[model samples]
Target chain A: MPYIKVQITRENVTSEQKLQIIQGATDLMVNILNKDPEATFVVIEEVDTDNWGVAGEQVTTLRKRQAEAKKLAEANKPK
Target chain B: MPYIKVQITRENVTSEQKLQIIQGATDLMVNILNKDPEATFVVIEEVDTDNWGVAGEQVTTLRKRQAEAKKLAEANKPK
Candidate 1:
């Protein structure tokens, strides 16, 4: 049995999108490892930004910082 | 940075239980790998019985079969 788990930052995902993720993961396991689809499990988890931090910063703050840095870089670029 | 995802068959888990899982995973990663608690991510997913299967049987069906088998074995056992 093969178990595949995907972790995503909290966001509203459409049911169709979830289906795609499930099918895609299952296909990869079956094709690459020759695992039986019936025995393969795919679980997707949507994590809160605060609970899913990186580099000691919450994702919400990290994205804000990234955006600000990008704006500054664009302003400093020569024409 | 360490990411831990827990997949459980769908059940009504209390908020406290979820917190335990999150904290436990984060603690393990930090203690074992020296990962920063702020940089570690833990997500728990409750999978539907239909979506989680084994040996070509869905979890719902598998559980039912297991219960039946246990009952039969108990009945057949000599006193």
Candidate 2:
């Protein structure tokens, strides 16, 4: 059986999006790996920003910093 | 970098248990694979029974059937 796990930040992802991800992953295995759809499993995991980290920093903090940088850049854009 | 993911049915797992899993998984990589703990990532995913399947049936339905069978067997036990 082919099992796939997809992890993403918990950002209000809809059930419809999850369904699409499951279908897409299953399709990829079936098409490329010639895996049986009936035996394939796809699981989606949503982790909170506070729990996820990048570059030794929590994603929650990283997002806030990134947003502030983007705002500063926009304010400095040429007229 | 080594990334480990553990998936289990969501059954009121506590934060402490999750922390243990993360630590245990990281230790495994460190001891056996000789991976750096700083570069190792462990993610624990808790899935709903309805979302997980086994033997072509949802885990929710399978658990119900299994519980009923266990109850029936207990009822038939000798006095």
Candidate 3:
């Protein structure tokens, strides 16, 4: 069982959305590796945005990195 | 990989204690299931005690339940 835990700053997501995210992540795992979602425990934890970081940088910076990567990928596409 | 996440209220524990807890839990898994710690990702999240619960009951009550169970078992022992 591959356990994936997500620490999210956004607390406003409904329980259904939370379950969907868990299932969606589990689905990705299952689709990629043929693992059973029932065998995988995916936990999504809601935490204060200020409490998490990555590579000694704030999470907002990480989000920005994703957005920048998407922009760069879009720019490089053949028109 | 079974990822076990622990959300604790006590925040002032030494980093050593934190690591020890992670290793201890991982050791239990390893001893029980012969799982590799490297492959079995166990993440322990430090959360406010007020934010966590079990079976619609607070974590403190859960601790009490464990203590009570131990006491009952002790009382029933042949020794």
Candidate 4:
């Protein structure tokens, strides 16, 4: 049996997407690892931005900074 | 920040149980890994038993077999 789990920093995911993930995970195991779907498990979870971070900064704050930097670079670009 | 995901072959898990898992994971990170709770993410997923297995047999079937074998051994014990 293979257990696969994916964690994304988003909320309100639709059931259809969850099903897609589950099927894709099962298919990967069967195709690559020769595992059977009846014994495969896929779990997708959504984590809040505040609870997800990198380099000692919350994801929410890091995302905002990234967006600002991108906008600034675009404004200074020659067109 | 650290993300911890748990996948268990069970369904209809109570909210309290999930909370305990989340808290336990966060505590582990903070205490052992030196990760901050504010940046820790814990997601507990409940998977169906039909999708879990061990030793090339479905977990459900394996458990049933184990239970039956245990009963048989008990019945054959010296009396």
Candidate 5:
């Protein structure tokens, strides 16, 4: 069985988007690996930013820093 | 970097349990695969039964059928 787990930050992802992800992953497995669609499983996981870590820092912290940097750059831009 | 994903049906899993799973998975990768714990990522995914399927049937449907069968068997048990 070709099982695919797609993980993304917990944003407001719609049900339609989840459906598309499941369908696309299943299609990829069937087309490339010659797997049966019935046997392929695709699970979409939405993780909270607080729980997802990158470079030893939580995504929540990283995203906040990015937002601040962007705001600073916009303020420095010539009007 | 080693990334491990653990998927389970949504069944009231607690925060402590999730932490344990993350630690256990990271330990496994470090002990067996010689991977650095700092570089290991463990993500726990809780999926609704409606989204999980087996044998072309949703887990929700299968679990209902199982519960019904169990109830029937218990009722028919010899006294």
Candidate 6:
């Protein structure tokens, strides 16, 4: 209920991927908090990176964070 | 700094008008709270109407609210 909807503009993701992310986000919210997806309302907008920024900073940081997190998760994977 | 960005899907507004709305929203924040527009990052995504909803309600309510407010203001116009 108190989540912020984020719109990302990038060339790497397709519309199907965006929809998957939205559904995945809703699942994360529900699984983590036992909330309904309908009440949780998820919206994802795909945009051009040049068109969006964060605190006067480019949203490249978001992608960077995701990449780093993935690397960390892979590194900690058990055999 | 704590504002939620809203993406609107409508047919009546141009991109320039959307930009104006973004600037106006930032102005409202600054004027009402004395905040810096730069610090108050604004992002506006133009969405398709079918892609947006509000609490299981269509976003047509938003446009209706605006129209009603405008009509009320016009009716109360001072001579």
Q: State which candidate, 5 or 6, has the greater TM-score.
A: 5
Q: Is model 1 an incorrect, acceptable, medium or high docking prediction?
A: incorrect
Candidate 2 residue B69 Cα shift, in angstroms, is 36
* Most DockQ-accurate candidate: 5
The prediction achieving the highest lDDT against the true structure is 5
Q: In terms of TM-score, which candidate is stronger, 2 or 6?
A: 2
Residue A21 miss distance in model 1 (angstroms): 13
Weakest 10 consecutive residues, lDDT, candidate 1 chain A? Answer: A11-20
Tens-place lDDT per residue, model 1, B1-79, is: 9988787888688899999999999999988899999999998878766555443345666788889999999999999
Instruction: For candidate 2, write residues A4-77 as lDDT tens digits.
Output: 98989898999999999999999999999999999999998789665554433445666899999999999999
What is the number of backbone collisions in each predicted candidate, taken in the order shown? 0, 0, 0, 0, 0, 1
Q: Please list all clashing residue pairs in model 1, or write none if there are none.
A: none
Q: Which stretches of candidate 2 lie over 4 Å from their true place?
A: B4-79
Error of 6 at B17 (Å): 4.2
Q: Mark the regions of model 5 whose C-alpha exceeds 4 Å error after superposition.
A: A4-39, A42-79
lDDT of 2 at A35: 95
Task: Give lDDT: candidate 6, residue B64.
Answer: 83
lDDT digits (tens) for residues A4-35 of candidate 5: 77789987877666666777778788789888
Q: Per-residue CA lDDT of candidate 4, range A38-76, in tens?
A: 777665557899999889999999889989999999999
For model 2, report DockQ.
0.08
For candidate 3, give the docking quality class from DockQ: incorrect
Instruction: Put the candidates in lDDT order, highest first.
Output: 5, 2, 1, 4, 3, 6
